[model samples]
Structure formats: structure tokens, C-alpha cells
Target: MPLVLFVDMDYYYAACEELRHPEAVGKPMIVGTGDTAAKMSGVVESCNYEARKLDIRSAMPVAQALRINPDIIYIPADHDYYDRMSGRLMEILKAFGYRMEVISIDEAAVDLDSMSYEQGLVQGKRIKEEIRKTLRLPCTVGIADGKVLAKIVCDSAKPDGLKLVERKDIVQFLSEKSADKIPGVGKKTAEKLEAIGIKTIGDIAKSDLVSLSSAVGSFGFELFQIANGIDESRIVEHYETLSVGRERTLDATKDVQKIYLLLDELSEEVYREITKNGFRFRTVTAKARYSDFTDKIKSKTLGYWTDSPEILKQTAKALIRELIEEKPIRKVGVRVSSLEMGNKQMKLF
Candidate 1:
């Protein structure tokens, strides 16, 4: 088993704002979802704990956030800015070892199985401290046996905190927490588990495999393994690029046909990429981000794999209709995955 290190930032956008505006420290601060700060069209992309205490949170509408904390300073997001700092931090990590994976823009998974326990702990602490000192940002780092457990540990150690999960303490740490606290278990799944009298991770860990499978499909089986502090997924240096698609955060408007045209345009872009690479996809997935920040994904499998823009657009349009809500749409995206060479022919020559 590989030892993993997970680094997570605390109130990332809010912290970035505070770095520029020192006065915003200790005051409620939030990052606006889009260019505007008015209406339900714009949501809070991130907010400090102070803002969160006032019912201002990430993904909450700016209008609603203002109602909660009127004095909050709104900052626009700058992924480019964050990216520059993140790159510098990764350069520092590269000096330490090669078995590192940048999981997200802000977080990463690093393997330290080659080092001793004490050596790994020291390296983890150094990475955490160095990031703060170099970037003037707060990060929480966790050390555990695998990626999922490392993330759980990092979640527990927010705001420049660090926690090391030894093999002996993994069971105790997971058991005391709620199942919802597990990485992949969302609100719907948590509620379902709660209905079955399995609220805590400990209960899920102790649950019978047969009953667990019957309750929540394969997710239950995965959750069961997680509860027992077992994760086998390794950190890959580079994962394949799945798909590339852009979505716009549209304003609240009653223009269904216009939205359809936009979806077609996006599908055309995806089609170009697949054709360029000679890739044919079996599945086309469409995502909808509602004005309220609620999102849903719907996918349609094709009878025949093809890299045709016209066909992709048609499939995407169908998916959009089924998943679309009557309410205003904030964002939309199309993705084509499950890609491979078009067909294989075996002939005796």
C-alpha cells in the first residue's frame, strides 16, 4: 500500500481576496460567481468562515448572501492568478519526489511509500509549512495510507492544520465520523443511509455486505470498504484528458431556442476534438447548472459510435430536454466520453 499526502486550501478564493485587501481580514468576504454582484444570476463562489456564519456560503446567490451579510466585500475569481501560485508550489513538491499527482487545481495526492514513517511525516510538514511561507496562503495537509483516507484526514485538518493517520488510528478516525463525511457520499445517499439506521461510518463499517449492497447499489459496497479504512487506488502522475467543453452562465431569460443553439455550438466543438483524434464515443453527457446552483448530469448512449457533429448535437439536444428545468439556467456543458478506436476488424490474411 502507498502512503499518500493530501493538501487542501481553506476558503481558497476568500483567502486570495484577503491577501490583496488586508482590511477584508476578520470581515465577511465572498467571491462573486460571475461578473455581476446583483440578482440571483450571480452566486457566491467562495466566502470566509465569517461570511459563512452569517448564512453566506459558496454557491449561494449573491443577492441572498447580501441579505445575510450586507458588509461583505465581493471579489472576482482569477483562476490564472491561482494557477501561477499553484505552479510555484508544485515546483517545490517536485524537488521532494516524483510520485505526485495534482488531483485538482488546489489539491494534490503525493505518494511517500518509499520513505520511513518519520521521514514521511517530516516531508509532509515541510510541504505544508513551505506553501504557507512561500505563497502566503493557508493549506491543510494530511498523511495516510491511500488517497481517500488522506483526503478525509485533510478535510478534518482545515485552515493550515496537519494530521497524520497511522494504520492504528485509521479505524478510530473513520468510525467516529458521519457517513456523509466520507468523500463521495452526498446528501441524497446520506439521507438514505440514515433511514436504515446507519448514520455514522462505524455503523456502515459494521453493516452486513449483503444488506449494504441491497440498500445503495455498488456505492454501498465502496462505502463499506472506505469505512473499514481500505483504499487501493494509486496516484497516477498523469491521468488522461477526459474531455474539453465550455459552459456559459446564462442570465435568467425565457429563450429556450437560444439555449438550444448554444448547446449545438458546444457539441460542435466536442465533435471537432473527437474527429481530430480519430476517437469515437459511446456516451454523450450533458450537464445543467440551474440559476440556484443546483446541477444535474444526464447521458445518452448511442446505438453506433460516431464522431459526427450533427449527431452529437442531436443527442445533446435530447439530453438537455430531459434534464432541463423550467427555471432559469445558469450554466450548460456537453462532454463526450467512453471513447476508443471506431472498430476492430480481425481477418485471416
Candidate 2:
């Protein structure tokens, strides 16, 4: 039996400032673009719990945040500093010897397969204490039999708290929630469920198999399973992304020559990035968007991986030509995938 724990750092960027400058602890602090003339026009990346009281939130443009409270303290986001702290947190958790998976820059899940549910609860509190003691930062931990269950528990226990949903209590915990609480049930879908009188997780649990599947496809049944506290997904440690790419938008045009020029520009930039990253890729994909926002893609799989800029550019150009075939386009992108490290140029999988 795999017991899982999810630890999520509370208001990470904003908390970092409080940890470094104790004076900022009880005040509203914002992490955003630097103090330039356009500082107020920039984006707010994160804000402390104090700032949130005024409805200031992440992704709210700085201008709006200032309008809420002019006296709010602002600091430029230092991604390097945040990344260092995030790495340190992961290192601390990894020391616990669980099979760990980083959920994001500020969240992670660990498998406690060797321990019983009770043991996991004790270990979860220990982890929370160690992180606070070692980093002077606050976080919340959720413990459960699966990742999704742990995530739901963790989300509910925010602003520094710990929660547990043991195997036996999973269904009861889920039953008290809405259909939207199940992953993949977004606002629109939840409305659809509500329209059909499926308001709660328990409603979803008892939904008609045919109608539910028709409503949301196979995922609907999966949602039903989740409502019943079933999630077979594993705690994977790594995911190898198969591609790296870039895209650009321009005024819509029917001129094939103009499209070719855009493709050449994108190809060169993609090649530059690939070389800079020391990656060799065997697949080239070219994608285009029409004026109507419709998109299409064409790809070429090389028999052998190559780091040569010439080959990459040529393949990208050829794929772009074949894809558009003189059709009008509003945007174009080029990417190389099936990547490998160094000069090996051999597919690892």
C-alpha cells in the first residue's frame, strides 16, 4: 500500500521575502517586476496573505494592486533566489528517503509505501516541522493513499496546516464536496452537471454510466471513479518532454513568400536555442495558425538525430512548406523533438 504526502509551500514568493526580512512578516509584500518607471504597469507574480486581504492576487497587474493599497510594499521577483529556495526544499524532503515527485516549484508529493497510514500521518507532521525549522518558511502537508486525494487535502489545509484522508475516509471526504472537486470537472462542465442535477460528488458517483460518458467522454467515467475515491495514477518521478518549440503571430497574410520568411526566422531561432541548450533532436514539427485561429501541423522524423543547424533549418522549412502549401497563415512556429543529450544523437527510448 502506497501512502502519499503532498507538501505545498504557502504563498511561496511572498513568503520568501518574509523569511529574509523579518520586518516584512506582518505587512503586505508583493513580488513583481522591478521598480522601474513602468513598475506599476507590470504583473504581480505573488503577494503575501496581508495583501490578499485587500483582494490583491497573483497575475493581477501591478497597477490594480497599487490601486487597492498604495502603501503595499513591492519587491522585484528574483527567480534565481526562488529557484535556490525551491531546490533546497526538495533536497530537504528527499533526505526523508521517500520516492518523491515535485508537483511544481512550490509543491511536491512523496510516497510512503513502507509505512502504514498511521505512520504516514506522523511522518507528515515531522516533514512539516522540519521544513519550517530548516527553512523558516511555512507550508501545508496532505497525506492520503493517492496523489489526487493528497492534493485535495493539501489544498483544503492552506496557510499553514496539515490534513489527512486515510484510505477508509477517502469517500466520505469526497462525498462532502461538489462535482467540480473531481479533477477535469471545470466550471462549464460543472454547470452542465448542475443543469442535469448532478451537484455533488455523490451525484457524480451515482450518475448514469451512458449519459455521463456521453457528456464528458471516457473522462466522465473516470470522474465517477474519482468521486468513488478511485485513482489508479502512480506517483511518477519524471516526465521526459519530447519537444521544445517557439511560435509567433503576425498579421494574416496569403503571401507564400512572407510565410517562408517567417518560417526561416523561426527555424533559425529554434536552432539557436537547441544548440545553446546542447540538445540534438531527430524530429522537426512545423505548425501554423490561420486567420480564423485554426491550426495545423506537419512533422518530419529524421532517421538519425543531428545537432547541425543546417539540417534543422532545412527540415523545418520543408515541413512548413508542405503544411501551408501556399495557404494563408496568421502565425507560425517551429520545434525539434525526440531530443537527446550531448552528441550521442541516439534516442533514449
Candidate 3:
């Protein structure tokens, strides 16, 4: 049996803030966007567990969070500092010398190869302690037979915890979890499963392939397999960088002119990086995160590869215009992919 370990940092952004300002450790605090003097116009990027108790959440308007707890400390987001911390965290994980996949800035999965479950527990403890001692941060670790299962277990044990679920106990462990608990099963997908009377993982385990497929298309096969304790997801040691992108949170707004202005700035940044690396891309994708934290993405693949900044700006603006019409956006991103090295003399088409 393959043993995988998933590590998730606790309340990552807020926790990073707490590290530098210990006085704020036990207080209700949030990291937000926009100028600190005008924080009410921004949105919460992250909040500590202390703030969560008062119903604060990421993407909530800072004004609303303040109404929930007037005394809550607010700090504007400093992504550069967080990125530095993430770099250091990755360095520590890499030292463990196991095949790993970084899921996000605050989460990663490591393949233990042939380690037994008992050995996996010991290794998990070692990782937890190393991170605590080195960075003064708390993290949770979950060990299981596969990546998805390990991630599920990790989430269940948060804010400094470690858990191990053996193969024999996988089904019982997953039985009561809602269908939406699976990583890729979002609210809409879960509602579809609910319509068919498949409310829990246990229900899916007992369901036939035809019934599951009829509800969620081809994803139902993976859902059924995971519910039955079969996860074939693997950890890759290396992933080729495929995209150049930039994103930022702004004062929540639906103004098309303001959004287009920001998109132009982001496009310039992305174009600089592309030119610096001698790469031309054929695809432009625009991403928008609404105030409710739901994200929508739009992509356009050009017929020809080019490094033209005008094309990048025009394509991104058109895509973003489509999404901004749905809701007020708190964050926006521009990405270019389908890359190839371009000669210095390549035409800017």
C-alpha cells in the first residue's frame, strides 16, 4: 500500500502575521486588501480562527467583518512577505527528500514510497516538529493510502494536528462525509448528487456506475472510486512551468473602466516576464473572484503564437468583461499559457 502525507498550514496568512506580531496572536485579526486607512472598501484575504468564531471569512467585505467584531485587528495584505515564508516552508519540505507536490502556498502532499503506516506516523510527527521549531508555525499532517484521502484526513485535523487512517478503516472514515467534501465536488455538483439521493460518500460507494455517471458525467467514476477507497493520484517531483500570470485584489467593484485599467497594468507585468524569458504564448485566460469567493475563468486561444502586449491586453479585457457582469469582483488575474521559446526577431503578431 502506498502511504501519502498531506501537510496544511493553519490559517496561513493570519498565522504568518501572528508570527511577526505576537501581541495579535490571541486577538481577532484579519489580513485584507486595499489601503489600511480605507480598509472598509477592501475584502478579507484571510482571518485567524479567533475572527472566524465571530462569523468572519475570507472574501467578506472588511466593513462587514468589522461590524461582526468592532475590535478585530485589521492588517493590509502583504503577499510578498507571505511568499517569502512559503519559500522557506517549501525548502524545509524539500529537505525531507520525498517525492512531493505543492498543492498551494500552504499545502503539499508527499509520497512516502514504501513506508508502513506506523513509520508514516513517526515521519509525520518529525515534519510537524521541524516546521514548528524552524518557523514557529503550526501545521497539520494526515497520512493515508493516497493523496486525496490524506488531504481529506488532513482537513479534519486542523490547527496543529496529525492523523493516520489505515486501508481497513478508509470506508468507515469516509462514510459520513458529505458528497461535497471530495476535493473536486463543488456545490453545484453536490446538488446534482443530492437530486439523485446520493448525499454522502457512503451512498456513493453503494451506487452503481450508471447512476453516478448520470448525475455528474465522467467525474462520477472518480467519485465512486474514492468513496470505495481507491485513489490513484500520484505525487510528481517536478512539474514544468506552463504559465506566466499575475493577480491582485482591489476594492470590490463592478466598474468596467476601473477593471480594464487594472487589466492593462497586469498585462504589462505579464508581458515583461514573457519577454524576459524569450517566450511567446497563444492562450490568454482571465480569472475573477467575486466577493462571495466564487471564481469564474474565461480563456481564449489565439490562432497564432505571439508576444504582442496589445493582443494580450485586448484579449484579457474582453474575457474579464464577460465575468464582471455577473458580480462585483474582489480579485482579478491575467494568465498566458501555451508557451514556446521565441526568437528575438519573431514578429509581434
Tell me the tens digit of each residue's lDDT in model 1 across 225-296: 888989877887641223435465577544778778889887887777666545677788887877766668
Residue 277, candidate 1: how far off, in angstroms?
A: 22
Q: Which numbered prediction scores highest in lDDT against the true structure? A: 3
- Which lDDT value does model 2 have at 148? 79
* Shift of residue 212 alpha carbon in model 2, Å: 2.3
RMSD in order of candidates: 7.6, 8.6, 7.6
Model 1 Cα shift for residue 2 (angstroms):
1.1
Global lDDT of each model?
0.77, 0.78, 0.87
Q: State TM-scores per candidate.
A: 0.69, 0.68, 0.72
Model 2: how far is 177 from its true place, Å?
Answer: 2.0
Candidate 2 has an lDDT of 0.78
> What's the distance in Å from true for residue 236, model 1?
1.7
Which segments of model 1 are wrong by more than 4 Å? Answer: 36-40, 239-349
Give lDDT tens digits, candidate 3, residues 1-349: 4799999999999999998888889899999986576688889999999999888999999999999888899998776467557657777997998878767778889999889888999999999999999989899999999999999999888879999999999999999999888899999999999999999999999999999999999999999999999999887643223567888888999999988999899999889877865778999999887877667899999998899999999999999988976679888989887776686345444
